[model samples]
Target: MDAVPLLRISRPHRLSEEVGAVLEKHIRSGEFGPGEKLPAEARLAEQFAVSRAVVREAIARLKADGLLESRQGSGVYVAQCLGAGVFRMAAGVRGEAHPIEDIFELRLIIEVAAAERAALRRTPADVEAIEAALARMDEAVALSADGVRADDDFHCAIASASGNPLIGRFVAFVSHEFSASRAPTWSREGIVRGLAGAAQDEHRAVHAAIVAGDPAAARRAARQHLLRAARRLGVVLAAPPGARGEDMDEETS
Candidate 1:
């Protein structure tokens, strides 16, 4: 009798993550239909050329995502795929560059509105909160650090100052994706000391407009900030792996 062929399980890092990704791929591609029972853990282990423990771990991950259900005295089955948008957003963004632009596009609408509203509604306390966030960023930059968290705080502060709890919550919801997008760009060449300086200045401009109670200027500043950010990220994406370079730099941003 001939033995069945097992797939490769290469990639030495985060075995459970890879396992969950493979299972997610199968589920997404309909290899396992809705409500259909998955193969036994032992069978899955053989198919993936991994131990039952790894398979068990991956199943646990899927269950956490509400993708699978384990019934008493029975095997695991696929859950009905409801709230798919919730699932898509809930799948935390990590180390990937594809979703950055989409996230930025969403930010434009929300952030522009927030900036305009902040200009109209900002109080003494709101200004203080924003300035404190800026101060943190300044300290980070002076010490040559990643100010990504402060950057997030600055934006969220603006959302809060807009006087709408809904806007603040919306920004918070999309923030994980936004931060994931920034991680790669912030690590790019010319980012820490070069473009970061520009970003700091841009943020100051937005703050100034908000403080001066100029809604139009705040809106323009916020819009321009995102445009510059997108350009900078593109420069980073063009760079080669492990090479701090951005080729095709003719179209200067």
Candidate 2:
């Protein structure tokens, strides 16, 4: 029964995700109190200026997050007790002190092990998924686009290939959190071009190690790629444990 906030949907991000974020914010702010019924789907669609399908997807995301519940033959209502708090990563804005280094450190911990496991466990299907994502990234680069979605997909594919569903889910969450910082638009044109090309080369190295079923090589390549990526964004992560001199040497080589 609370007033819905105005939403201005932007490009280059999924509509459902944007809508879901708005709804989540209102719920967390207590504007939409616990146990209160939400507006009808049609009303929500009209309010958000999106189709019913988009509204549906946004609501579904909330349900999955355990922030809402549905009763048979009754409208959706906010959950009486908020379950586990939703995890989020805000887009790093210029001039604001964000923990960019800490984020990359988390990625190094998650993705390095993921790449190693993927190399050992990936099937032909998983390889194809990773390859397809890379092809999309290459095409986006050729068109001078940022390729953020494809880049996200590439990392998610690698995580899924690890054969641990939980790892795959965590990687997707991490990618979403870090995606805003990955866009090259704030940099000069020359730098954007150089970063895109260099990033592609690094991605291919990881792919090559996975295809060869070389676990150690894959771990090294994934770790090196993330480190270089962080530097591109002006972040320097503290060295995680187990990164020995030999491994660092191999990464540079």
Can you give the lDDT of residue 47 in candidate 1?
Answer: 87
Q: Tell me the tens digit of each residue's lDDT in model 2 across 1-253.
A: 9999989877687899999999988986679987899999999999999999999999999998768889889999997645422555544663454477767777888888999999999999899999999999888777776688788888889999999988976775456565655666223472455888888889999999999999999998898888888777767666546879965664454
- Model 2 lDDT-worst window of ten: 184-193
Number of residue pairs clashing in candidate 1, backbone atoms closer than 3 angstroms, sequence gap of 3 or more or interchain:
0
Best by lDDT: 2
lDDT per residue as tens, model 1, 20-126 = 88887787556887679989999988888899998999988888766688888899988654112132454366433455666776777799899999999999988
Would you list the clashing residue pairs of candidate 2?
none
lDDT of 1 at 196: 69
Error of 1 at 231 (Å): 0.6
